[model samples]
Target: MSTYVIGDIQGCRDALLRLLERCRFDPAADRLICAGDLVARGPDSLGTLRFVHGLGTAATAVLGNHDLHLLALAQGFGRARDGLDTVVAADDAETLLEWLSTRPLALHHAATDTLIVHAGVAPQWTVAQTLALAGEAQAVFADRERRRAFLPRMYGDAPARWRDDLTGDDRLRCIVNVLTRARYCSAQGDFEFAEKGSPGAQAGDLMPWFEVPERRSAGTRIVFGHWSTLGRIHWPQANVWGLDTGCVWGGALSALRLEDLHLLEVPCAG
Candidate 1:
């Protein structure tokens, strides 16, 4: 059975199907992992959710920033019209949201020695620490009462540096931002949440999260999306594969066949 890691679907069901076809994916014998941002900025958010969710145990998804936004919207937290209304208004909205909410922020594939996250990790964190901290934050998101209380307080870019002494909302927020929205970050473990650009475009000491010198997680293979401009099939230094090709932005939807590191993509109408 082959495992395929796909980039952000962002509601592009047709693109996703075509890409899957290109990979010759068979739900009965293949596994799928989504790099997240499963909804928003594209058509058919509801349809895409059903398609992936219908895959059942054959598919796994991490929570992306947009995915979290959909959860917050479900709790009557925000009023942003970011193309997710179809999902919120669906009859199965609650069920779909429940499934999405409980997914991990970071997952490790022991067979591949690959770490899967929506975005990237804090430079100071090792593979074990990334998973542990992700679990700490995941606990809050997976529980109903804690999620209701934390959703509104979740929109922040504070305390970029990860400290062991950090606690409460601050600690969870740091973990979420790093896992779901981080890109350029300092070697000191500080993140530039505001900068959404390609590597050469960012200024100052900020570098791509994986490129940070002596990044503890650097030794393990990391599969991530969220940086569409980074494009398909490129490993930052050698151990990471960035698959987002901006399917929601009129680019191709890409996926990596993890067993052999083969890349496949399908152009999207956007």
Candidate 2:
């Protein structure tokens, strides 16, 4: 059975369906790992969430920034953005949001030696450390009382550089930023939130997280999606694959086969 890693669906259910059909995905055998941003800003957030949620064990997802935003909205911490109201108003909204909250910030596919995250890992973190750190944030979501407090504190970009000594919300927020919102980072590994452009678009000394020299996680293959502006990059030299192709922005929905690096895509209806 093949394992397919899809980029941001962003509520474009039709495009996702077409892309899956093209891949000939079988729920019984094939596995689907989504790089995240499953719902938001497109035609059908509710339908998209239902389809992925229906996949059950056959599918797994990493939590993207949009996903977190949705979670926060669900908990009454943030304002509902356009296109997201459908999901919030759905009958199964609680169920769907709960499933999303349970998703990890990092997912490791052992057979492929690929670490899947919604955005990028901290340059200083190794594959093992990335997962461990992600777990810390995941634990917060799992705790009822903690989740209520945590979701509201989830919206900042303070403490741009990660430090071992950081405690409480600061630490978790940094981890979430690196895993979901990061694109470019300073040479010394500080997150550069404002530079969301493609590789060359950033200013001096700033580079894509995966391209950071001597990044500890560089040894393992990484599949990430947050930067749709850097669309469909397969930099084997860096062992990084960027699958987001701006499908929510009227581009194509894209996916990569874990075993062979073959690409499958379908133009978005949006």
Model 1 misplaced stretches (Cα beyond 4 Å) = 236-238
TM-score of each: 0.97, 0.97
* Candidate 2 TM-score to native: 0.97
- Model 1 agreement with the true structure over 1-270: per-residue lDDT tens digits: 999999999999989998888899999999999998999988878889999999999998989999999999999998867678778889999999999999999999888899999999888899999999999988999999999999999998998888989999999999999999999888787898999977888989888888888988888999999998873357757488888888889988989888888888899962
For all candidates in order, the CA lDDT equals 0.90, 0.90
Off by over 4 Å in 2: none
Q: Cα RMSDs of all predictions?
A: 1.2, 1.1
Write the residue-wise lDDT of candidate 2 on 54-84 in tens digits. 9999998999999888888878888889588
The residue pairs that clash in candidate 2, if any, are none
* Superposed Cα deviation of residue 95, candidate 1 (Å): 0.7
The per-residue C-alpha lDDT of model 2 at residue 119 equals 92
